[model samples]
Target chain A: MSSRYSWGADEHLVVQITEDMSLESNFKAMAMASDLASQQVDGLTDICPANASLLVRFDPDRIAPAEVERIVREAEGRLEGGGPQVLETRIFELPVWYNDPYTNETGARFRDRHQTPDKTDLEFAAQENNLPSVEAFIEAHSGAPWITSMVGFVAGLPFLFQMVPQERQLEVPKYVRPRTDTPKQTIGYGGCFTAIYSVRGAGGYQMFGLTPVPIFDPTQELPDFTDFMFFFRPGDIVKFRRIDEAEYNQIKEQVEAGEYRIRQRPVTFDLAEYEKDPDAYNARLLEVLYGN
Target chain B: MAIEVIEPGLATSIQDEGRPGYYNVGVPPSGALDLYSAAAANALVGNPSSAAVIESAYMGPKLRFTEPAVVAVTGADIPVLVNGQSAPSWTSLDLKAGDELSFEILAGGARIYIAVSGGIDVPLVLGSRSLYALGAFGGFQGRALQAGDVLPVGVGSGRPGLSVPEALRPQFAKEMDVRIVLGLYDYRLTDEGMSALVDRPWQLSPVADRIGFRYAGNPLQWKEREQPFGAGSDPSNITDAGYPVGSIQVPGGIEPIILHRDAVSGGGYAQVGTVISADMDVVAQSAPGTMAMFVPVTLDQALEARAEARARRAEMMAALS
Candidate 1:
């Protein structure tokens, strides 16, 4: 078996499908993790997939690390030349008020830690991406759908990879120093990924907007969060839909009243077609989420 | 009747074996940092290995027991006192009703474990009684023990007089060797960097906590390569991936941060290596300013070390039984 992974102590095994981030690597990791989970291997606690790899945590006493390596290699071999997997996923339309007041207040408080303290995070990101203005940057950001590459820095925080061509993807550095405070529900962007602050704590990502809807409800108050506190799982698709402050306020009210419902649709993701025609495929994904 | 907190120490929280199986959602397995010490305390008090215990940092909590309790204190070089009378540590002692328990300043190590006959009777969240303070779930009221807070204990089954052998107890050292099985992105580091990691002595930073232990050491260099797309500009950054407990990552190649039990499950930084399971408890015991030396070992050695640890625990239990 090929050695394409790393051992984390005796308790964890990480299988690196690729060295870099790409949709193909992410899909491979997802497929392998899904296959391993189906095995219901005893003593295995978690099978977590990331951007280009997956990590398995288990009781070493119950299942030897060597055995884990053997099983993973076998599963990886089985997935070679395998056809595109049909992934059971959900497409969510998230409402965002870009450059909202909450984020503006928090970002301004941590200006000393930012790269471009004089300009807002949106302005800096726009200029870095060569966009004419913040509005244009917002358009580009919301134009494409993003896949949930991983869900973990903190609970329910999904790292999203944009579904656009390499050149079209936006990139930005994190804060020079992380802010001690970050408001919950703040939409943030760093590197080539996007995320929402699930719970207010400490964060370094440049804040871009604020989402009115909740992505994590620890109380399980929302219907979508009945079974779990987290709304988005790994491999879920999300599209950022711009909303006006008025609509944001309305949604906020509904959320407070516990009557808000996140707009989402059940969908199946085909990786092969996505690799061939990313643009058309992304458009169809959005259509499935928002189309009548 | 239950234990009442008169004063919470630097940081006192309820911990057990930890809530596993939820790292995928970013929930860390918040438990006693020093598993051996915790198990020793529980064993002394006639509780199961997984029984709840109070994990204290730096200082220890002052508690008033409303009812008599069989108690034991383990970890760190701190004195255990009952109503101003010094009591022996690592040995079970019976306390009468209204007996007040307290501790002295830590002479060494960072954490101490206090176990009562009955475990802390807190509602289990996600299947463990350990405290996840970051998310405010599990443990006693989902937070650290505060002044005036009351903690009920579970009905314990074992009797006192059980103590681990002196040879079995962990020996605290100012300078220690922490073994690692390098991988998960050690390839990103240059040969010099890899050598620098094991060759130098690293001092634990003052900011060390449950989430991670930050160490100050020589800045290492990374292999030069065209930064990949989606990967951040930082030389130490990768496309965010799952972080294994005990994994070591250097954000700027200056301070090496070792992820611990409460660490985030996944992130973007390139991890250079992971501390072997046997030494993770040692890492927890090291106090700030203590020096640590990284030692590289093979998988077979790591597995052998783990087996030794299990055998040691079995020996302790056998001696008590």
Candidate 2:
């Protein structure tokens, strides 16, 4: 496969593996990024892997632009011919409160910015997908596992793509106008990607629910976030499990008490197998996460 | 060994070379916007190039020194005042205990850097003293300096009379040509749009801040194509991707925004070009309403420019040594 990449000024490089959003494209990007990280090239300051592209930041003084480009191109060539690389990844089960009161109140405050001002974001999204009701939409969303394609837009905010086939994938447009305020942990959906707002700020995504767990902690107070302040990394899979407000409050208490250990299991993600049979692959991933 | 803020002018905060290596998790490398000036000030004050300094935008702070210390001011063309007396910029100066320091009204440029001997002894977050105010995590209390805020200063190894020559300093101008390497998603733009990007004169908008520099220019047009799956209806929106700092993105294909040191690592906007590293300091110095036209350069030219910039910093450090 011919991989396309470009120079981002003298200090950065952007390698685009594909034009559209797909699990294969993301997997390739992750593999390339992971491979680059292992090289430990001097002056390679940061490596950010997105849905279908990889951005590498380097110090021009320490490493020449031409040399860095050569290294990246070489890595891409090896990965292209090396066949599929199975990466050691983790699967996380996140507790979400669908159509929660907090998100509902937030949606009401930003009604003027939504396509359907009279309806909540969950309502509009459910109706847009031809679902019978909000409950049906919630069931569909929670039923399939989603893969974390990228982590950005703030710290630890994961951009998740549903693992189901294209036909079954739910899509929604961003807000007609961006909202100045969005509650932290507000599970938002836009352009076929779901993200939990890591920190409250300006956002355009349509809010559907709220997550009780914290994805980002600057203090690094959480036990799971000991090594890094952020919990989620690219290529990690997450299953958004719907829960009641009571459960949300219970998790909140545990989090406040500093006893909340995020439910996750280490697993290997085989992109080749996942692409062949997504439903079966996802079920196995779920079983690994829940041991059922 | 401290300075007390009598008045925290516009946006004063502690900054260094910025915190790198965190963009993967959406954390931007928040550091001094005009790195050249910041490093020059640090050199003048006998500190390492990465030492933390005070970065003030528009207006400057009024601080009273608690002890005798050496200081240097760089960036912008504004006048620096020491105890009601005007002082020369780009030169090291001695501040007696209880001596007050302030700045005159805005003359030109957007920001100014003040480096004290040793460096601002703020606790480092992620190995940087630079402030990411949006996250409230680093710098002096992770926010802009406030009135009565007392900042601890490192011991002074710098001596007065160490000055940077006028010939070595960057010229602050009302209009300039900022060089960029146009690529990364530039294919999304139309031929006409690509031409307009380099030809048009863009005025820096007043809304420009540390996060990004927004320019008011001719609306760029995009190629007509069926909206790709996962891409939004807007012509400028792409499937969310990583944004290199200094990369230019035209949202709605109208105003082009250049991401800066305090920008989000990635987003959904379609990027067309990245302002070269050397010109980023020039971009930071450009004040609101300044006219800036983008000039396209090859990778070799960008590298040459960066080499020249590194030479200047090395020269400054040698002079101080």
* The best candidate in terms of DockQ: 2
Off by over 4 Å in 2: none
Using TM-score as the measure, which candidate wins? 2
Query: For candidate 1, what is the DockQ?
Result: 0.77
Interface RMSD of 1: 1.1
Q: List the residue pairs that clash in candidate 2.
A: none
> What does DockQ give for each predicted structure?
0.77, 0.82
Number of the top lDDT candidate: 2
Tell me the deviation in Å of residue B44 in model 1.
1.6
Prediction 1 global C-alpha lDDT: 0.88
Q: Taking the tens digit of each residue's C-alpha lDDT, what string does model 2 give over B113-142? A: 999999999998888999987777789987
Error of 2 at A210 (Å): 1.2
Q: DockQ for model 2?
A: 0.82
lDDT of 1 at B304: 95
